[model samples]
Target: MSRTPDNWLLKVTGLTKIYGEPNENTLALTGPQFGSNICPETESIVACADINFELYPGEVLGIVGESGSGKSTVVKMLYFDIEKTYGEALLKPYANAGVNTLDESNQKKRYIRNHLMGMVYQNPRDGLNFNFTSGGNIAEKLIMAGNYHVGGIRERASELLVKTEVPVLRMDDRPSNFSGGMQQRVQISKAIANNPPLLFLDEVTTGLDVSVQAKVLDLIRELQHELGIAMIVVSHDLSVIRMLTDRTMVMKNGRIVESGLTDQILQDPQHAYSQLLVSSLL
Candidate 1:
């Protein structure tokens, strides 16, 4: 595994968001701002607010919470899927320069996505191009990152497919022909095609069967360690957090209620909401 020597690969601070017209959105106050008391009928709803975290190279960080806890929103903002109302993130290679992704141009962001990071979504369709063959999907990422040789692209696709436990012979099949689990595996293969240093998994196992979920999670665990990549895993399942992440942050109503080692948070939750969440999982 080739790893950068950076202490913090990713650092986030004061991540916040609000939806709707400006002044109409409940006076636009900054939030510690986990959740809002103002009725949505009043106008603005806070999706996530004042969020902060630091991710070290080769470290796995888990953001776990119930639906609507703002976990997904944070990742969406980071990956540039949606615009953030406000926030800052500094990533390595760019760390010393302290570049916030939100401040980067679209072209630079595109370059970063293709060469520096990877993302796997819960819905395979969001990540996979159903019309493209499995190998083609992976090749797309490589091409965008500037690889041009057909032979090299195909060879790398086969390597990644095998690594992800997908059959190499199935490389030419379109994702539309795959089962949900297989499609997700293909997506994972594509995400890591560039051997990106940072990865994001958002609700990856949400719709898989239990056995399939286990295998997919195992693949993720093995690949992360093998590649020495830093990752942010977003899930509502605490079990997923326990199995994959080194540290866990418990979020509620769009705010992180508690953050600590996974074992510590699960075994000795301090926040009322976190306690309720853990107990409910019992």
Candidate 2:
């Protein structure tokens, strides 16, 4: 893909993360035993290694992989929830401010999360505050972003609830009070509360039934098109990716094994892993 100087919304290069490195004493119940036969004595479990990808403005990049493929790890690193062991991540601003670099020391990632990036996790319960009402959750995000006016905050919350097709009447109810689908909608509302330039959706529809998943995917596509925001959708559901994303990247063992236009990848997969993934979807 040709990356324009101005069009790149996110850039990731040589990104890697290693956990439970040698010298630590973390133990496992049952696993292969190496030198010390201790979890911490083994070398790092490379969750992601030398990962490279770029997201352009208004594009949806689907990352498809099985369990332990590092999909969640990648998203977490992008959100700065976990510190990366190595590599660089840059976010291009929507206002032509140029690419801002993120790393362990610079802390630029935090700034991006606060103002430019948003995330929706696979489990809505994980993302939403159970104690807060749906409107309160959305309003909390706005307030955290520095908008303090009560009337304006409530108005925006109501508008977003409507945008996400969540009833305004349910706005005052806690997320725990809603059904799974409704809770997911509330999570989407909270994610877009700030109108972020980039969104990371980590299996947002994973546990929902097929019908509910379809509805949620449609809502995401509608929102993405309407807002012109860039998105990275990490999912194992090939059908969902095919329906929602512009392009797809197939990952295995912490590396991108194959990537191409969604249709092309589905029709003519280049890598063995991609072929297997595509075949399983069929």
lDDT of each: 0.86, 0.81
Model 2, span 176-264: residue lDDT tens? 98878889999999999999988999999888988988889899999998998889999988998999888998877666778889999
lDDT (Cα, 0-100) at 57 in candidate 2: 83
| Runs off by more than 4 Å, candidate 1 | 1-6, 22-41, 95-97
- Candidate 1, residue 174: the lDDT equals 95
Q: Which stretches of candidate 2 lie over 4 Å from their true place?
A: 1-6, 22-43, 94-101, 104-108
Query: Ten-residue segment with the worst summed lDDT in candidate 1?
Result: 30-39
Q: Please give the distance, in angstroms, between residue 116's alpha carbon in candidate 1 and its true position after superposition.
A: 0.7
Tens digit per residue, CA lDDT, model 1, 51-145 = 89888888899999888778999888999898998889888765463789878999988988999889999999999888899999999999999
Candidates' RMSD to native: 2.8, 4.8
Tell me the TM-score of each prediction against the true structure.
0.92, 0.88
Clashing pairs in 1: none
